[model samples]
Target: MESSLSFSLPETLVLPLKTQLISSGSVPRSPSKLPFHHNVSLTVSLTVGTPPQNVSMVIDTGSELSWLHCNKTATYPSAFDPTRSTSYGPIPCSSPTCTNRTQDFTIPASCDSNDFCHATLSYADASSSEGNLASDTFNMGSFDSLDMVFGCMHSVFSSNTDEDSKNTGLMGMNRGSLSFVSQMGFPKFSYCISGTDFSGLLLLGESNFTWMLPLNYTPLIQISTPLPYFDRVAYTVQLEGIKVSDKLLPIPKSVFEPDHTGAGQTMVDSGTQFTFLLGPAYTALRTEFLNQTTGVLRVLEDSNFVFQGAMDLCYRVPITQRVLPRLPTVSLVFRGAEMTVSYERVLYRVPGEERGNDSVHCLSFGNSDLLGVEAYVIGHHHQQNVWMEFDLENSRIGLAQVRCDLAGKRFGVAH
Candidate 1:
């Protein structure tokens, strides 16, 4: 069966990111009391062929579209074929719902008759695709089943890493106003993941620990940077303290004045591998650690960290000193509000494989192209125990420092 509705974009319209951001203002109200934890991760039932092969799908807030891997016979290679399933429909581009889900990147709305409901989005890894703003009924486990329609992305592709990522596609959470997660009556759901555990679930419908808030409650701003694909969140910088081997390192004003807006956005991304700091900012930090580095770990050629030289040794800095200096509080000059993250949170234990006599041993921040884009990017590596909330309705994201209430207690006590 052929899909009856096909929404395509115009060939010549150009819209700026600022204009697109304004469009996001019209999105539906966000689910209330968000930030719920899923004791168990939820899974999606993917219908691949005419017979309906159910593949377990992951519910991700990081993506807005839902897709799965299949053979060549699969519709569009990257898209979900509506004809093969009983839960899809053809939504016209003129429809308000369609406009909400689609965006115009390389083209403009005026160039085509499709009303800008067709879009082409690209990811940081340079993967790109084209699709229309449409909806499809999705099954959320046996408990929460409904016609949850979302962007039916076509010709989609992404960079695969490791073995597990190949079969997975993204379910975007950043569809401006067209976000399907908000359309469902159950506005809030928990996306709980286990450390070192690839298997996680999407807690759809609702949970006891999760709470929903009004859309008008919080403030949110879209992050702007040199790199467009990294859909990042910007936060105010607040440095609580800076210490080198138990000694306080004085922070210079030239390095952190708010007006030097060139620092870019402090990125909150789940896709990136590590957090990067600017060259100037990194220099100031290194000055303090000069004495604290206990020993050196030889840097190898073609190192991922990209140190200045091929053979630079990374010195060890004691953890206790950075967290608690003589000063009552270590101030971090930031773009907006001054905030201090936990010392334990920043100090990472060197992976055993990369430790002593191996190659690099330093846990210090390094230079990354991402630094040029925005002030900082808080990658997935740093997202631990904290519950992050991206409320479209409220327009602001909330970060809560939380502990797993059921961590040690789950699975009948960890013998």
Candidate 2:
């Protein structure tokens, strides 16, 4: 069945955003504490089909392949129909495009009666999808790309249904050949996240403006030697230290480092909502934070030594509209640069429906005790008001503190 949702496609096409960001509905809460499975990932609006059916999807840099969660049953707000598009075709299971689950630890796929690629993706958050892989036309604005391959999911499962309402699928932006970024061949891309608006700008390809702006460069580290499963899977940056205000917190760099046997280094995830620090790293951060703002911030009652304990460092503030003095600008000190986390971005406003009051906010940073001391994740929330550029070609990333204007976007398609 064709969807009847009315939305206008952008009139501009050439420099169509291979990496764009938008927002959706959902209440983000701790998975164990509440049923809300909200994410702060940047969502992109996809224009699919001949007439162009618009669908929202999450921009997951950690994932390798892009897939649309299909359900004719209205389980997903939008889905791609290969049968309807003349440009659509399936990849045979024998093709290199079709990978085995055990071979490279890639997405799990099986051959159907027609020998088409059928795959399943299971995430750490209990979100999963089982589907058939196919190729078709992918359009954004006026720009059109032919024979792009993606997944048409048969069934999708997530811990939160509200998240499904926000996005129909995943737009994997990893270094894998199947990812949207690789398919587009835009090695250099940049984005700026808004701390206040929760909206941002995405610019793909080379630009002269890159040199004009003051940018701090850091080497993008990868897994020592990569297999298909480990190659350019995530943006890993070496974090040297974390500073609260003018004082640098006394936490060892080893506390933030990840085992090379694992994903390697600290990760920069645009899809994850909250920043996660390991046990020792978190303890030092929390203790220092509380010690500095002792009387300024009041810890919530019925909570453990560190505010609400493991899950968060919540506080009861008398905030209605103005910024509170209790909130500090947390900085993530990287190898080549330091990123100042905005006070607004560091704290989350507890929804009024839960506590029946709007005065409570919790730190977006969380303890990763449950996941073990694996790696530190600098999530989307912590990157607010910062312009982060991913230079895949050079294996480096540039960061700067500034809000970018989205007007007068340049458009061009590389042949």
Candidate 3:
């Protein structure tokens, strides 16, 4: 039973819904040699097609669809002509939302010879993409721009992604129905994650701010349910226990319960940067965070040098400490609310963006059982600097620890 539909606007044209903050632009990927920002990315600034073409996208809540990498003559970097959009459209195959998401998406038809509707999106770092499927006019940054239904991608399902490793595409904020917060009527959407600074803030609907606190809510848990009708759009949560120095890690809240065939599920994924646990909650949180930072923490090694890959609890410091030393008290509980987190927000570096200015602030948390199973994937370094609000018509998921207003102060849209 795959379905889709949601379109209703006329609250006097979009009433009181004015809080735009989409400002994101941080890209530091070097992947190894370990100054390890691991790929701190989050770009957004689109104005695609017809008299608009301003592309810079990559704000993906693990994607649902949104795309635009049209190839233009082929240098691939931000190309989007879509036939010079005059409101572009192209979706044929008798559009039943393109044969119901390509017959329940295992998406393998690539639709050509003129039936339109084609797609391929894959990534777990393998990186992929394939094109065709349009509908234009997506501006959404400086106050407004609409008429969505994206993906005009010219193709690159993978050949090791060249052309500067592509990506002038993807905006999908999942929980599908052709996402973008289900076509811009945001039943709830929020973002605030300053991995120190790429300058972030993405709230779109909800919050009138007459505040006295009130913002700690929880309940998202989907875990790609039994994985099929096109992989169930995961956002999962329900962790319930993990407080270090505040003590509480006998982990086994049924190992974070998630077994509809997706292994003890866990996914908060802001396009996964680092933070994965499951293998009994990453061996009881890497053996209780290395038993509370062995040797009282400090591992930016130069003298004793130790750089184990896939982050477990790295600490090494001193090439002139690049910040991050104030551990003990890690919190993640979430049933009623608990975020604590801070070892420089679990070790993320933006302090002078590190270009081999290496020292090591690792401890961004990992161990998805080394990708063999027992899943968990939090990422965005467990959402550094907090503040997320995905409400989706009250499906539940709110958080706090404010201070994100790139220029468009938000608060007013929580109904």
Q: Name the candidate, 2 or 3, with the larger lDDT value.
A: 2
Cα lDDT, model 3, residue 20: 30
Worst 10 residues of 2 by lDDT: 29-38
Error of 3 at 135 (Å): 1.7
Per-residue alpha-carbon lDDT of candidate 1 for residues 1-415, written as tens digits (9 for 90 to 100)? 1111232212111111010111121322122111112212222333343334333343344444444432233332333455677655545667655554334222321212555355555554455555554445543222223445454444555443331232334454443333444444333333323333322223433223434221111234443552443333332233333444445466565543323344433444444444555555556555554434323222233335433221122434343333322212122332322223344434344444343334234443545443334345444444444444544433444444344233322311111
The candidate maximizing lDDT is: 2
- Give the Cα lDDT of each candidate: 0.38, 0.64, 0.59
Summarize candidate 2's per-residue lDDT along 1-415 as a digit string, tens digits. Answer: 1112133222212222222233322212221111111235566665565655556777777676788866655556566665676766788888778864223325557898989888777764567887777877776533434456788888888766666656768887766667777777675766666555444455555543643467889998766565332334678888899888878988866666665455325777766767887777778888887787688877665354242234567777764646677467788899998888866676776656123333676776878664543567777777766777888888888988875333212221211
TM per prediction: 0.56, 0.82, 0.32
Q: What is every candidate's alpha-carbon RMSD to the true fold?
A: 11.9, 8.5, 20.6
lDDT of 1 at 121: 56
